[model samples]
Target: MKQPKGVFVTGIGTEVGKTVTAALLVRTLKADYWKPVQSGDLNHTDTMKVRKWAGEAAGTFHPERYRLNLPMSPHASAADDGVTIQLQDFELPDTRNFLIVEGAGGLHVPLNDQDCIIDLIQRLGLPVVLVSRHYLGSINHTLLSVEALRHRGISIAGLIFNGDPHPSTESIIEKMTGLQPLFQLGEMQALNDECFERQVQRVGQACKTLLDGL
Candidate 1:
């Protein structure tokens, strides 16, 4: 079977909705989701949440090897535990399907003393799905992030505007940057049945649109 294309999901900053967006993407495609490095959570909170949302089987999600007690940068959390996050330690299952690798934080997040999240993505050579909030300063942050990815020769599939209830910021981003807004995830305080169903439909449509281009 042909291998599925891989997509890396990174955010402008923490709480920018990377996990939720990733969950949506994976559920839409019914693809494997990988959380490469998790800190601050003891039992892979995001992975578990995504699995539940996706209705994935028990083994569909892969947890990162490095799980730190502190809710800080992977580097800092690893240091506190006297462990170093090594690139070689990062591995994904060899499956013939799309894999969504969710980054811990923004592009520049330090994974270890010598390497950052960008380094890992570059090494993986996976196209990125940037997740940014539709708020002030989003344009600057998104542009800089896109430029950085370009500098590293990374391919960006597109951008996902998380929590953009209004189209004000989306219009500006498209007009100014020329990057297509792949999805406009609405605000969800809780993952109720109604919200989950809506999210699933929206994400499923977005996935169809994205994959149609491929």
Candidate 2:
């Protein structure tokens, strides 16, 4: 098999479908996925959702290196758990064809006392795939996020417009920011087994095409 390039999946904010989009990318690339630090996972719901989306069994799913019970920023969660989140603790398998590292929240989210999420992404030194919603303020959030990544010297693979309701923002973002909206995931009323399978398949195909150049 060919070696896969590493891609970091991040979002403008929470509930922007970062994990779902990351799972679609992973399933499309048939690559390894890792979330270095996960917060607010009462019963590992987010990880499990990604696993199911990637069509991987529990054994195949890679566990997060740091799992915090608190549903807040890594800094807060770690503090609540009486532990510290360290970038040094996160490790990537060097042998995998491609590794997808998913962030917990938007850029600048505090991971520790001194470092934020962008610091972690910079540490990984991987290209980014930002996921944004289609609602208002997306333009501001997306542009700022992209600018922040560039300022940190991180390459952006592309953007995924998750839950884009208005079609105008698509062209607007591309024109203003020069970052193409790779995929605009439509609405899904339910996430049942059948819907999940369909969603994965659709996103998988779209990701394969969007990520072809990378």
Candidate 3:
């Protein structure tokens, strides 16, 4: 069987809007969404959020491999639940449509004593859509993230900034990494389906070439 075409959605740090970014990607591509390891907030998991945000048009929302209950790092959360998250436990859901696999946190997020989030990404062999929201030191975080991915021989599909555009910060990152952001999503006041649909079109249009390449 042919492997699914997909992109790994990860962030420089937590709460950098990786879920929103992944949902937008799903809407744009009509891809299947999966979160291999859900650390906490099982009541409202990332899979649920993406499905609600993008609506049915976004495609399927797959169940997580491990849904730990505590709202903490996967390693700690799994330990709290008396579970050891072995990567072998994960299996990519059968899908022909493009897939959007959202990661728990940054590349350094630990899944087990020896495996971090990046290791899972590497194992899956999927290119990444690295989300970097503008913050005080986001430029450094963003660059370092790209460098780390490069060091691991993982392909970065593209950068997708999730907050206000900081031209100075963005420009430096571009110059240093030579990777222009595929698209930048600003904060939304009213995050409704219609609003998210508009964002899907906007990012879809602006990043058409990038998406095409992917």
Candidate 4:
């Protein structure tokens, strides 16, 4: 079977469940996972988490292009690590199955002096799955996020709400952006492969066609 275009996983903001959603997608589609630029936390990186859960999913976990040392923005961390990030530095992994590329931070997050996550998305030509968690000002953050991607003509695969549902917030974003929600992952006390696989059963059916079409 021919491989489908990868899904680029991004979030409305930092600490908003991008990695969790990406891991679920990776397992759901049995897709390869890649996080291009890791700013820090190499000990427990997103790639590590995906590798841990994607174990029999046959998902290949690709290493980051830049493994910066400090837990800071890619730009600062790169500088601290004495390395410069360039657009030419990133290369998409070769895989026959679906691919799930998780972005760092938000759309505007800087990889270097000039390039940001949005730019990298454009460069990679991957569709996005924007993960949004409900917060006090999340409506604004989510809207602005949708606008940024739309403004750049990026394909938004869908939105995935990661915490307790806030219908009002979710509704407005969907209503305003006309972007569908693939799944609403509720808060769970324990997070593991078993838990993620359970969520996949609920979300996989909904997201499969959309991701395959990408």
* True lDDT of residue 70, candidate 1: 94
Predicted candidate 4 versus true structure: per-residue lDDT over 83-123, tens digit per residue = 89999877788777678999899999998889899999988
Candidate 3: C-alpha lDDT: 0.88
On lDDT, the stronger of 1 and 3 is: 3
**What are the lDDT figures for the candidates, one per model?**
0.80, 0.78, 0.88, 0.85
Q: Give the CA lDDT, 0 to 100, for residue 181 in model 3.
A: 86
Q: Candidate 4 lDDT (Cα, whole model)?
A: 0.85
For each candidate, give its TM-score against the true structure.
0.90, 0.88, 0.96, 0.95
- Model 1 — TM-score against the truth? 0.90
Each model's number of backbone clashes?
1, 3, 0, 0
What's the candidate order when arranged by decreasing lDDT? 3, 4, 1, 2
Clashing pairs in 2: 4-97, 40-70, 40-71
Off by over 4 Å in 1: 1-4, 56-59
Who is ahead in lDDT, 2 or 3?
3
Using lDDT, give the best candidate's number. 3
lDDT of 1 by residue, 12-43 (tens): 87889998888778777878888888898776
List the lowest-lDDT window of 10 residues for candidate 2: 53-62
